[model samples]
Target: MPTSRELREVKAHFYSLAGFPNVIGCVDGTHIPIQSCGGDEAELFRNRKGYFSINVQVVCDANLLIRDIDARWHGSAHDSTVYHNSFLRARLDNNEIDGHLLGDSAYPCGRYMMTPILNTSTNAERLYNVAQIKTRNTIERTFGVWKRRFPCLSQKLRIKLEHTLAVIIATAVLHNIAIQQNDTVSIDNSPEEDIISAESNMQPLTSEGNHYRRLLLEQYFM
Candidate 1:
């Protein structure tokens, strides 16, 4: 977990590089498949793709260094649901989070959360979505490199939930270390190499959020 001051630095760095104001990080979730436990808990760990797994949520900075990891949730949990109950939500609700975080359509649009407009009403809206998608690809490729480097993690993890959680967190720690050390790994540039997409059934967190989105469209996007 990054300190509030560290997050502010992250936000400033993103603004300087991408012209996106108040962006501390990008958020996403990837399902790590695991072997069946053969109990009622088995169903809870089964994802929509018909596999038992852990829904691993991650927050990453622009340089693809993970800022946080939440692997405690079951695979059946929705990405939005996992995020809503997180420390991030509590911080945002209290205005402790100084800047917003970028996410895909799977996450709801909130005061400190930005998502692309579901339906474009103008060319500016279209362009805004394009840029948002392009900038948010950091999380996607981060997960890609994490899983591809440790192929066993991408496959059915033959371990219990507690052990699985430890493994996931350790891998994330190693990932950040690798990034800091400038470690190199072969990347699969094919779009198909990305993790499975979320079911993007999104809505704004509050009426105020809708108003903010409109202001963004009118000011920066226009």
Candidate 2:
């Protein structure tokens, strides 16, 4: 979670990219492959892509700095489920944060969590989607850079699940340090799969969220 001052800075950075206002960060889930900890509960780690992994929920600013992360969920868990059960969600629900997060359609829209509109019948809505997506892409880029810097995240972690979780956090911390130090790594041409997918059992959008999104569109995009 960002401080009030940091939130303002992040919002300005996001708005500069695509004119998306009041966006504090971009949120998304990325799967980290892991070796099976064979047991009756081992099947719980198998994801939709038929791989054993952990579903890590991350929130990053426009500078590609990770602000928050939840790497406790198994790969089988849906992105929405991970978010709903996250401490960040509770903070947003309690109005602890200052700005909204731009997530994909997989996340439920709320006063603090803005998701893309499914049906856009107007130019304003379309523009809103474009701006939102452009600003939201920072998380994807952050994931790409983080994984490229530490190949262990892209490849299967051969350690125990407990240790794997610690390793994930450690790498994320080191990644942030690199970003702070202005360290650059050449991104190769390796194909990074799109991890953002629709949830079959989606969470219902809140009325407040719908109103907030509409206000943003009419105020800035229209």
TM-score of each: 0.90, 0.95
User: Which sections of candidate 1 miss by over 4 Å?
Assistant: 191-194
* Minimal lDDT window, size 10, model 2: 188-197
Q: lDDT tens digits, residues 72-155, model 2?
A: 999899898999999999998898888889998788898888888877999999999999887888888889999989998989
lDDT of 1 by residue, 1-222 (tens): 467768777877776654666677889888888898787778998887778888888999878888888898888888888898888778778887677788987888877778888768899788778767777877877888887767878788998767988899889889889889999676765543325565446555567667777777777777
Q: Which pairs of residues collide in candidate 2?
A: none
Q: In angstroms, how far off is 121's CA in candidate 2?
A: 0.7
lDDT (Cα, 0-100) at 116 in candidate 1 = 81
The C-alpha lDDT values of all candidates are 0.79, 0.88
